[model samples]
Target chain A: MLERALNGGKLYWTWIGFLLAVFGVGFLFYLQQWNVGLGITGMSRDVSWGFYISQFTFLVGIAASGVMVVLPFYLHDYKAFGRITILGEFLAIPAVIMCVTFIVVDLGQPYRAMNVIFHPSPSSILFYDTIVLNGYLLLNLLVGWTCLHAEKKSIAPPKWVKPFIILSIIWAPSIHTVTAFIYAGIPGKHFWLTAVMAARFLASAFASGPALLLILALIVRKFSKFDPGSEAIQTLGKIVTYCMILNVFLLGLELFTAFYSGIPGHMHAWEYLYAGIDGKGVLVPLMWLSAILAAVSISMLVFPQVRKNETLLAIACVCVFFSLWIDKGFGLVVGGFVPNSFEQVTEYWPTLAEFSIAMGVWALGFLILTVLYKVAVSIKEESGGEAIH
Target chain B: MKIERREFLKLAGLSAIFGLGGTAIAASVQQTPSYIPDPKELTGKRWALVINMDKFKTDADVKRVIEVCHTKHNVPNIPNPKQEVKWIFTEMMENVFPEQQDKYLTEHYKHMPFLTLCNHCANPPCVRVCPTQATFKRKSDGIVMMDMHRCIGCRFCMAGCPYGARSLNWIDPRPYLDPKKINPEFPTRMKGVVEKCTLCYELIAVGKIPACAEASNGAIVFGDLEDPKSEVRKVLAETYTIRRKPELGTRPSVYYVIGGMKDAGKGA
Candidate 1:
């Protein structure tokens, strides 16, 4: 039975080919990072965290958004979401995996990521985020797999899995909030120095992350046999639209407070992002592109017709995902570094070497997702083997 | 062939139903800690600092404190910008804030160095927020300090500091120090760790004044804030002093008396 389940789907050698190419490129970049240290990456004294960390920061939100969907389905017995629950769990696994990899790459000492466990700092939020992120990953993985094992045998998932789901349900936002606390707890980086920053972060995660997932749903619908309840997809899209609007509102509030009050410390980031300080002209087109994409995506999502149309929906989803990714990845990270305490506009762009290494980390994440998804899909397909090719 | 995704509907429903209850549990535990080892010893002293910015008259004086502090500590100065480290470095606010550079201060007193370092806030946020126990506030005193080897170079502390006081060494900081210019009094910092002024910990640990205090030749006052008879306490009592951004409510331990007009004007 297990062999029949596993052997149903084609091995997808094309995917394997793509994965290897990404991995090879990534490997070459990783070598550069290993030999030279972070110098090969664009980081400096004032803006310490750059490409690696920005990706980490953005992905943590994406990882946490898995729960935004998870909470509704498993814990509440939302029958509509039964088909999509595996995607959430598995997507979470990759998001969390990516999140972890980003931190490792960003660290001046990748090996020392473990010292958080060995030499624990109970006071630090990063310590707690580390703990919760790992625990959350294990919980989702264990719960998801336990169910998968039952699915494989055509049996009911054991009652023991309930506790893991419940723990994970509560644990998801904790991971994101702790991630936010890593920034919000700081007293003086004006842009980051807000109690609401965490709230804003989660809000953006809910909006942008779900948009990414819904977009993924459309892709799967196109390339795969998974229908994954369009009603559920539309419902999640509505949630993303609602959250995205709120996120934009909060961003407006942030800008008003900084610029209207005329606090240079607070306004410095705004200028760096929108206006381009010291004529760096660096974040100029990127920030505008992000804003326009965000607006169009939100608009597309607002209308039922556009949301239902797969091609259009995919376009909207891609735009929103890229928009938020650029905002978080480039805007926020580099923005914080600007008007650095020294008041110099130190610009950072990821070199080909850095970008390639980043691609490697991302490829590694995708590889894990691919394997996990393959196992999950095969088992699910066996339960209803008549539909898929 | 199928790209089957296990749709996470049930989990999504679960979180929405009880997300707040989870948040409430989190809310109860969310009271974060601060690095300021504020000894609750109910002392006659709430710790404070009194800086005579005027006493920083010459570049040599500013250089003296940095030199002594760097030497006393093993602060390496690697030449690359990534690794460049400093236990004490001069920051021209004009240099640091050139765009906001005003004519009032620049026109009046062209080259007055604020000689800034870690304000060591009574609310030292850096100590509590460092994940690997790398940065901490000394129990005996409120001076926030760092342990370099333990630092993972996460730089979260740098992000959290309200004062913009913390710095990260982006490269090998040890190679850049001018050997002859290297001050033998204090230690230097390494790359990757966040570091700032320790208020001359070893100096104060011994029966001596801080390097900055010594350089000022009685211009800058240093003594136990706890001691009623201490000179710092006396200065605190006598003068109407100011701190760098009291609005942030960081409760900076470093106090300042603005001899120059540019002093209080830097309200940011």
Candidate 2:
């Protein structure tokens, strides 16, 4: 089954080559960062976390979103999702890898990262996050691989795998929730101090995760014989629609609480993100662009006519993916740091080396995703163009 | 390849015992001896600092205190404000105590420079959020202590602290330190560790006080809050003092005596 990924068309090999080139460039910059320290990045004492952490947050959501397909098929017995559930699980494997990589690159002492495990602090949310994320990754790998391997043999998946599938279903939300707790539990960070943080994270994750899955499914359908079924794609589109709506609504609630209450601590971060604070608002234009994209994508997704059109749906997914990327990945993390502990604004923008390192991590993830998806799709195509359940 | 039930049971039992015994040996090997306090150490139930803002009469007075602490600690002198790392520094009264600031506040109160350092909170969020026990509060005297070697430099503590006390060594700090001025007694931090004021724990171990407190010319007082007769307690008893962001429930050990001066002058 693994050998299937090794044998690919020229286009596939070219794509792989492109990703490798990008990864190589990024690795060089990462080496520079390793030598110089985090001072190579734009992060400061005022804004301690920057691009790397934000990417980690976003990718965690992507990993958790695998539950969307897994839950419907395994728990609710939604037959349509059975075709694409493996896709979701395989996507999660690479997403989790990327999340861990982003965190490692962001660390000032990447070698000492195992200290979290060696000297475990249950009091810290980061400790719990480490446990859940690695657990979720293992769960997805086991469930997806076992089921897919069983399918290749044209037999029912092992009965023992069912309990693991159920566990993965429950474990998915815990990963994102623990990640949210990392920020929400911090005392002085008013922007992330809201109780709704976990809920908001889940909403955005569900939206962005399914949106990316929808886009990937479309791409897979175009390039491969595996259809993934139109019904499955439409169902995912619906999931993205509802989740994006909830995500926007939760964001609106946050805005209302910040503005209506008129709390300086709460409102200051919002002001810094959307409007210039003391004439230093680098993220203002990007934030507004995210807002416009969200509104446009949500409106387009709600209409059945637009969603039924594959071209229109792909555009909507792209919008949702990038919009949420900006909102959660860029805005949320940096906003919390902006109106810093002293109510002073200090802007953060990733340096070129930082961007290169991040891009390399993304390329590594995609490289993994391509190989996994190739194996999964080839197995499906071999089994008479329909996914074996 | 099949083994008899009796033989399988024996093998399993033997491996289990060896595994348990190996783990016990490893744990014993890893165990570190407990610390013994020096007899000459200045003992306290809860060490605290009270800054007499009135005593800081000149800009040079505040600079001298900051210089003494930074020099003693080997804190890097990074000129870039964005990447600057400081154990103790100064901020205006208005910025330091934003909750206390107002339009009607006098210029003397508004412009006064207040020394800022780690509060070493009684219920510190930094200690709570640390994934490893890199930063912890000393149980003996309630001083917040940082193990730079243990710190992974995740900067979670920086976000957890409300007073902006912690600083990450963003670059190699050895180059930033002057060779002649480098303190041999105190360890200079590496590029990838979070550090902050240790409240002069080293000095306290030798029956002295914090470097800043010693250099402040009576502006800073250090003592045990648990002791009723301590100078810090007497200062708190007499003067109207405030802690930064007390509403956050961190219960900072550091206090600032506000409006205690008979003759207030322009701040530097």
Candidate 3:
């Protein structure tokens, strides 16, 4: 399978080279971050977690999205997903990898990462997050690889794989839920003090994950002999549409609870994010853009005609992906720290070093994704279409 | 390949149970005590602080306390307000207790700065959320303490703390120090760890009071809350006082006596 990854078209090699170049630049910036410590970033005593932790939070949702396909296929026997379950699992691998990298890059002392493992605090949500994330990563690797290996051999997957696949179905939700707990469980952080956090996280994840997968499937169709099949793409679009709707509804509930309750603590972060608090409105425009895009994307996706049209569907998926990214990746983590415990608004915007390091991590994820997708697609082509029954 | 189908299923089932069960057992074994202590067990020392608002006659009084604490503890005097590391400092009443702010009395309370520091809460959120147990409350004295060497510098404790007491050394603080004026008695902290006021735990161990309390001219009272006869206990008994964010239920040890404006001519 790895050998298949070594063989790719000129476009594939060029893409890899481009990502590597970006990664190289980002790695240099990381070295500087290491030397200077976290001072190089925009984070302060007030806004401690900046871009890195947010990205990690967002990517955990993406990784957990694999369950959307897993549940529909394995539990409900949705045959259309059989063509693309490998894609979801492969996407998760890189997403989880990127999640771990973001945490590493964000650390003030990367060398002390092992301390979490050696001294596990069960009371801390972070300990559970680390456990579920690592477990999910291993489960994906085992299940995806073993099943793909069986497909290559033209045989039923080993009897052992079924159990792990079932376990993975249950495990996926735990990763994002625990990640949400990292924020929601905090005492004084009012922005994240909601019961629906895990549910909202899962909704956005289910939407964004499949949305990204649909876009990737279109790319696969354009560039290769393999067709991920119209049925597969259409089914995924439907999944994205429903999840995006749920995500929007959940967000509305959060807004209503904050505004209607009129609790200053609950409304403070929303006011800061949506409208500037005390005249500092760095994220206001972006949040509005996210809301507008969400509405447009959901409207576009709901119509069967637009979803049937490949180009329109692709456009809708892209909008959904970016909308959720802005919501979860940008505002969610940073906004929680606003009105720091003393009720002072200390804004955070990423510095060049921080952005570059983040870009480098993103590039690394894409590179891993590209290699895995290449191998999976090559296997499908070799097997004369979709890998297995 | 020759193994029976039933045997394979049995083997798979057993392995799955053990595989998952083993991790659960290991995590349980490695677990530390919950950050929340048994209230009944907290029988010995219950250190508390009482800041008399009436005695703060001038800004220099608060400034002097901050200077001594920062100078002794090697807290970096980062010029940037955003990146500053403050262990103990004064904050205005409106900012410190927003809920207690009165629009009609705003002008009168303009200069009222509450001496704020780590609450050393009975149930400290920072200690609960620390994955490495780097920040833990001392069982002996109920002082919330941080182990810099063990800290992973995750800043989870910073988020967990409601008092805004914990500060992360974002960079190596050594460069910011005046080497000629560096305090040799206490160690300077390195970058990438959370730290806060230990209620001057080291000085307390040596039968000495905290520098800020000593320098406060009887304004800051430090004594065991459990000992009813102690100065802090007596101050609380005699005066109407308030704690920061008591609604959050952190049970802060620090108390503030907001004496009436009519008593402005007299000091505590």
Candidate closest to the true structure, highest TM-score: 2
| TM-score attained by model 1 | 0.83
Q: Tens digits of per-residue lDDT for model 3 on A1-389?
A: 78988887788889999999999999999999899889999999999998999999999999999988878888888887887899999999999999999999988889999999988998898899888999999999999999888888878688888899999999999999999999998888989989999999999999999999999989988888878899989999999999999999999999999999998989999999999998998999999999999999999999999999999999999999999999999999989999888889999999999999999999999999998898888887777555453
Query: Interface Cα RMSD for all candidates?
Result: 2.9, 0.7, 0.8
Task: Show how many residue pairs clash in every candidate, following the order shown.
Answer: 64, 0, 0
**DockQ per candidate:** 0.33, 0.70, 0.61
Error of 3 at A333 (Å): 0.8
> What docking tier does model 1 reach?
acceptable
lDDT of 1 by residue, A32-148 (tens): 666566767777666777888888888888888887777777767676667677777888888898888888877766667787887888888888888888887898789777877
lDDT of 2 by residue, A1-389 (tens): 78999999999999999999989999999999899999999899999999999999999999999999999887888888888999999999999999999999989888999999988999998998899999998998899899899889878798999999999989999999999999998887899999999999999999999999999999999999888889999999999999999999999999999999998888989988999888899999999999999999999999999999989999999999999999999999999998777677889999999999999999999999999999999988877544444
Worst 10 residues of 2 chain B by lDDT: B20-29
Ranking of predictions according to lDDT? 2, 3, 1
Model 2: CA > 4 A from native: A385-389, B1-36, B264-268
Better of 1 and 3 by DockQ: 3
State the lDDT of candidate 3 residue by residue for B16-55, as single tens digits. Answer: 5778564554455357456664433323387888988667
Can you list the residue pairs that collide in candidate 3? none
When only the first chain is scored, the TM-scores of the models are 0.93, 0.99, 0.99
